[model samples]
Target: MDVVQQRFAEWVYKLGITLTERQAEQFETYFRLLVEWNEKMNLTGITEREPVYEKHFYDSLTIAEAVDFNKTSSIADIGSGAGFPSLPLKIAFPHLKVTIVDALAKRIRFLDEVIAALGLDNVTALHGRAEEVARDAIHRDHYDVVTARAVARLSVLNEFCLPFTKSGGVFIAMKGTDVEEELRDSGYSAHVLKGEAREVLKLKLPLEQSERHLVIIDKKGSTPKAYPRKAGTPLKSPLVDPAASQ
Candidate 1:
């Protein structure tokens, strides 16, 4: 095993998870593809080898804890730039039906190439904005789980993710330590997404002192059709708080 693969394996094992050889190879291939493609595209800034392992690979793998793979079959990574948790999670759980959505055609092109190179059968990369795709009957309310990483403010992120989540599905946002403040600021936009903050899981990464928060929101009911409200409106006119309404 190469140094990178060995280190990744140790990290996953320490996280109370195990990866088969096939899974590890998938990650290795993904890392190679990311690095190769990044040379030409602005896929990610963390190009150094170690940083790629920690920030890209490990950071993406952290979502495994928040998600129940047994119950989850379909997942959509909204705004999945360079295929973070979606591709990694799919590697870990090969049965997962994963779709990565990115608005930028370039990023989607990169993702498609990576998917093809990896021979990943269960994943699809879609090129379109989340707001537009989430409204389509095929995408709207179809996923078992939706994930986003540093996509937007909690309020805006909710709008982008929730529309694609099934009523019982969950949207897991990989966030930094400021999740509490973001959630507080989200307010009515949270309600508009038909979701509520379910729980926050604090995580520790190897050699990283900074904290990370996985904000899990459960989609409790149907989001009102009027929601997401065009491109710029959710951030501008969030729903009225029910408590404030009272």
Candidate 2:
């Protein structure tokens, strides 16, 4: 194994994830594609071998720090810029059926190429706004785990993600250091949407040791019909904690 593979393998091993040779090769191909397509359009800023390995590959797999893909099957990644945790998790755990939703057509095209190149089965990349897609009978409330990584604040993310999460499933918001403040603002929104903040998983990245928090919310009941109002409404006017703001 090379230096990059060695580092990634060691880090995932600690999380009870073992990478196969083919899986490692797929990840390498993914990196190559990311770099290649990145030249044409913006995919990611961190494109170096080590940073991509640590920030994108390893950081994506950090969802394992919260819930094991070994047990979960269906996963939806919202606003997956270059297919983070979901794609990496799919590589590590081939059993997962992944659905990635992103707004940009270019990103969807890139993701489609990546899926075809890697020969990854049971994975799909959809091009549309999260709010609109969540209303589709085919996708609405149908995931075992729905995830958004650094997509938006918890309040907005709750609206974007919780609508597509099946009742009793989980929506994991992967955040940075501003988790406490985000959580405080999100409690009311979560309840309004019939979700409950279940747990917060705090961990650090391997080399840089950057702070990461996975806010796990359980879908206790179906989201209200009014949620995710429109394509841009969530971002324009995010749900707020009436008490906190007052």
Candidate 3:
């Protein structure tokens, strides 16, 4: 095994996660492809091998520790730039049906090519905006888990993710240290979307000592249809202070 692959394997082992030999090979292939494609497409800025293993691979695996995978059969990764958590999670748990949605066609193309190259049968890449895709009957309220990694603001991200999550499902947002403040700002929209902050899982990765928060928002009921307004409306006019509006 290469240095990157070996370190990744050790990290997973230390975290009490096991990947079959085949799965490890798949991840190795993905790592190589990401490094190569990034040279041309600027898919990611973290080019160092060790950083890729920890930030991209291990960071993605943190999702497995936070949620019950058996309860979650279907998931959508919104604005999946470079397929951070989705691709890595799919490789880790192949049974989970995963879809990666990105507005940029180039990123979508990269995801598709990587999936095909890895012979990953459990993932799909869609090139479109989240709001447009979520509005469709086939996609609306379909996924058990809707995830976003470093996407929009908390309020805007909630609008983008909540509409697609099934009742009783959860929207897991992978965020940085500002999670508490974002939650405070997004309280009204949380109520509007029938979501409540369920839990926050703090991550610890190798080499870097930064806070990664898994903000879990449970979809208790159906979101109001008016939600996820046009492309920029959520950011511009979010549901701030639900009681005042009522």
Top candidate (lDDT)? 2
What TM-score would candidate 1 get against the native?
0.93
Off by over 4 Å in 2: 243-246
Ranking by TM-score: 2, 3, 1
User: What are the per-residue Cα lDDT tens digits for candidate 3 across 1-246?
Assistant: 777777788888765578888888888788899999998888888987778888888998888777777667999999999997888888877788998889999998899989999888878899998878888887788889899999877888889999889898899999977578788888778888889988888876776888888899999898788877887677678768856566
Off by over 4 Å in 1: 235-246
Candidate order, lDDT descending:
2, 3, 1
* Candidate 3 or 1, higher lDDT: 3
lDDT of 1 by residue, 1-246 (tens): 688778888897766568888777777788888889989889998888777888888888888788868678999999899898888877777789998999889998888887887788978899887878888888888898999998888878889889888899999999877677788877677776788888999997786657889999999888778866686565566555668656
TM-score per candidate, chains pooled: 0.93, 0.97, 0.94
Error of 2 at 234 (Å): 0.7
lDDT of 2 at 198: 84
Q: Write the per-residue lDDT of candidate 2 for residues 47-132, one digit (tens) a residue.
A: 89989999889888888878867789899999999998789889999999999999999999999999999999999999999999
**RMSD in order of candidates:** 2.2, 1.1, 1.9
Q: Which model scores highest in TM-score?
A: 2
